[model samples]
Every structure is written in C-alpha cells, then in structure tokens.
Target: MATFEATAEAAAKNLESGRTLRELSDLFTPMAIRVAITLRIAQKIDAGRLTAEALAADTATDADVLERVLLHLVTIGVLTRNDRGEFGLTRIGEDMLVENGKAANPPWLDLNTVAGRAELAFTRLLDVARTGEVAYSAQYGTSFWDDLTRDPSSGTDFDVVMAGGMERRIREIAEAYDWGALGSVVDVGGGNGTLLTGLLHAHPRLRGTVLDRHAEPALRTFEDVGLGERATATTGSFLDPLPPGAGGYILSRIQSDWNDADVRTILSHCLEAARPHGKVIVVDEFATEEGVRCDSEDDLRMLVYYGGKERTMEQVRALAADVGLSVESLRKAADWTVMELAPAEN
Candidate 1:
C-alpha cells in the first residue's frame, strides 16, 4: 500500500510537469505549422510526396530538420506516420492545403503572410501595454491601416484574408437580420464588398452600396459577384457624411479599430445616413457577461494594431443612445453580435 501511494504521487507529479512544459512550449507547434505551410508541405504530401527526404528535396530544405517538423506534426495529429516511414495529411492537415477552394491556406496558418505578420506583432505587447499604443506601430513604425495603405500587396493580402475568413460570419449576419423590408443598404467601410455581396446575395430584393475611401476593389467585387446592377460602390470615409437616407446602414467589424470618440463619430455618420425608420446594423465583437467569445488573441491584436477594443453590449447601447439611435434588437451571429438600431423615438 505504501509503495502504490508513492508511485501514484510520482505519476501525478510527472503529469503536472508535462502539462507545464506543454504550456510553456505552446509556441513551438504554431511556428512549426507555419514553416510547414510556408513550404507548402501539405500540398506536396497531398500530391504523393510523403517521405521527408522527397519533401525536403522538393522544398530545398534540410531533410533532417524537415523530418523533425514532420514528426512534430505527426505528434500533433496534423500528419500521420505509417510503419513504413511515410507521412501523409491527417484530417486537420487537409485544411492547410494552399488550394482547398475557399477554405484554402487560412491566413492565420501562413505566418509569413501579412495577416500572420499582424498576429506576430503581438510580440511587442509589452510596449503597447506600457505606452497605451499599438504594438504594430511600435514594431513597424506605422499604424495597421497606414501599413496596409502604403503597401498594396499587403493590403490585398489582408483583404483576401478578411474576405475569406469572414465569409461564414457574413452569412450568419445576413440570415440573423431581417432584410425583407429594406430596399437599399450601405456597407460602411466595406472592404472589397465581401459582406455587402453576401448580404445582397442572401436577400435578393436588397440593393446595396459599398462605402469606403478606396472603392475600386469594392467596385470590382460588385462586378465579380454579379451584383453590379444591384450594388453601387462609392468612395467616402465613414467619418464624413454617408450617402444619406438609405433604408439600412451596416458597420461590420469596423468599430473594434477605434476609440470611443471615433466610434461615436462613425455611429453618428450611420445615424445621419439612416432614414428615421431605417435600420442601422452594427456587427462587431461584443464582450458578453459569459466572457469574451471572440478570440482573446484577436482582442490583443486589435490593441497592438489600432488601439481599438471590443465593446460590451451595454457599452454599445450607450454609444447608440448618445447618437440618438436605440438598440431595437441584439442577436448573436457566430462569434459576433449584430445589433439593430433605429432612431430613438423621443
């Protein structure tokens, strides 16, 4: 009995130590995954280059180092290794394919890309926490928006990720809201018109407009989505006057990039453009009483990139009230909240 008790305690301590080590080394998996994605290893594996030697030769990487990465991936269930010493894509590994058709190379998985660069900017979180400034700015010496604007390639990459990543969320938002009565809706700060196109496609009767300072890409999106006739792209800042008196106005995932003052200004623009009876839809990450459902890492990313924050429903209500808009309904769509607002009845 004494020996058994001692053995049990020893096992528990070993387990605890393993857990602690895993927690500390959590960064290793993502970095390894990123390297794999960068080398298109999943694609190569899918194409039948399963051995580390073949993959390393094709990718021009060291065979031994690549084998270590493959071994790590196998341990993490991303890849499967057979007794014959062959590696192949596991279920999760398939998602890392560079050409998975709409599900392709998720931006977060490609750490060498712009979106990944944005995520990696979190390394300077200490600077952001110290100065109440964005870590991206601290690291890159430019705001996230400015960085994107200055570099067209990075901007396009960012837009692609945003569009692809938010496609499901956009569908959820469209289905959650009632657009039967609305004739025209404006998507404020709509990037590449992805959300607008989704909403327009979901509601056939709803004609839409994409409002952004750079409307060229959005115009192209409208044309590509077969929404050229039903949608219009207009160039303007949400901080300025919107195309006035639309039946609906949408601000999706835009508020989390600004402080209260700027958010209020944007809300006021939505209010001014929305017809008295029109719906002003604010779709964003809301901190709930149940705790933040949105990615906490993403919340930190917002702080590091734009000095913005995810707001609670109560905070959103107050902002709406300040702008003479009342929250008529609040609905959860995926990880975001879709708050429908209308002019307050005084």
Candidate 2:
C-alpha cells in the first residue's frame, strides 16, 4: 500500500506530464479517423451536412453511433460542434478534403481505396516478424501484385497514387542528367510513363520507351501528352528480358521495392541489356544512419508490404558489385539519388 503523499506526488507528476491514459498505445483514434474518411464525413460537412443525422443519412450509417464518432473527432481536433448541435471542420480536417474529391488523405490512408485496404496488412505485423515474409498475402489471401492484376481499376488507382507529386520530381530529374546525350532510354517498370513523358518533353531529341506490366495506360498517356511519335509502351516485367541496346536503361525508384537477390537479378538484366556502351540509371533514395537521415515510415512499409527494404548506400554498392556493375556516377536529384551504373571492365 502506498502513502497519501507518495500517491499525491505521482498523480501530480502524471498531470504535469499532460499524458493521456493511453496516448502511447492508442489504437482507436487512427481507426476512427479512417472510418470518418471512408464515410466522407468531411466532404459531407463541407457540403452543408451540419448535424449527425444529416451526415449519417448521407453515409447510410446509424445516426446515434455517428454522433458519438463526430464528438470523438471533435475531441481529436478534426472537427468542432456548435452550441446549436451543428458540426464543422477544423483546419486539420480541411486537409482531408482530397483534391478532385478523391481521398481525404493520401490514397493509402483513405480506407476507401485498394492502397488503403493493403495498409491494413500492418495489423498482421507479428506474423511478418516471425516469418520474415510480407503480411499482405496473409491479410488479403493474394500477393499485392496479384491483387492489382485481378482488379484493373485498383491497379490504375495505385498508379495514380504513385504519380502523385511526381511532376516536380520528374522535372528536376530530367534536368539533372543530359538526357539528350542518351539518345534513347527505356523506363523499366515505368507506370503510366510519367517520368519518361517528362524526359521526352524536356529533351526534344530524346526517344524513350515505357516497359511495364500494362501497356495501354502508358500508350494512352504518351498519345494524350502528344509524345506518341517519340515514346512507345510495351507490356513486360522487370524480372523478364528487357529491350536491348538503348543508351540508358532506367530503373527509376524501382530497386527499393525488391529484396536484395531480386534487385541483383534486376540489375544483372539491366546490365545485360545496357552492356558495352549504355548506362543503367537507377533513381532511388538511400537510408542513412547519419546526418539528415533519409529514413522514413516508408522504410517499414517497404518491408511489411512487399518483403522489400530501404537499403543504405553501402548495401546499394554491394548489390551493384554482385551484378558485375559499377556505379559510374551518383548524384542527388530531387528527393531521389540517381546512380548510373556501367558493366565492370575485364
């Protein structure tokens, strides 16, 4: 049994710390917000659905439960309630109104999309820890790629998600290297040809190809962007043979999504395709232990989602060496590191 003074002292310290009962272990808050996003509560409120009844009617949810959720959101600073029982969004809530009415947050956090659905695999993280395999298959009964292949719409949604904010990065990458000198480049595993399109646009003399699992979208994008003459799309996987003899074989932001062995295989394929004279240009970020630390939540996401990882610079060099390729040039372009690899001389 503790004395009153000791109890009082501990209580005072807890209060001074301003810690919630379970702030460090809170689970309900995230799911609640996800539920709100799925229901499009913010959009409804933005459209003048001020009361719980109105929002519930719009979302086809029970009014009483929804009112409780709305109040919880108010406590969490996502919303506010007026004296007259009307609800309104706070500034934080406004960020949830996705551009073009698509998602309140990134598609991964929207809960209404496939990316969001895939994120739920994190719930099976313990299984991932024990098996050292991706949890996505355990959670969804199919691999992530297979899931996408089964549903074309979900695959398109994923491509859109990947293309988010890539425009600025593409412009920066295009200017970083003398693409015109390459004459021709292949965007290996390129989705929708966003990067290749930008490169073609930046360097009028450059010809490019988009190689991916789907050809139609990239073909349509190239035609839509009026680069049809300079760009072509082909259906293929990076795990298979790539088109040969291009001046540059680009694996833009691709290596991080594969394990080391798979990365080595991909690099070997690129080296074979780009042999003798061509360069293999890889665009990705490194996980550094020192300085400004490029490590992020994405590091863990790569692991749990796909059995992939964010590798350190040293790991990247080792992977390159394993495939008999040497990094000829390495530079930072936008948020990604561009590494130009060449086959090691005999």
- Winning model by lDDT: 2
The CA lDDT at 222 in model 1 is 82
Q: Please tell me which predicted candidate would have the highest TM-score against the true structure.
A: 2
Compared with the true structure, model 2 gives a TM-score of 0.87
| lDDT score for candidate 1 against the true structure | 0.80
Whole-model Cα lDDT of every candidate shown, in order: 0.80, 0.83
Show model 1 residue runs off by greater than 4 Å.
1-18, 21-25, 45-95, 98-101, 150-182, 201-205, 275-279, 290-295, 331-337, 343-346
Candidate 2 deviation (Cα RMSD): 6.7
Give one digit per residue, the lDDT tens place, for model 1 in 208-318.
888876778889888886776899888788888888878989998888888788889999989887856778998886765444433455666678778888777888788
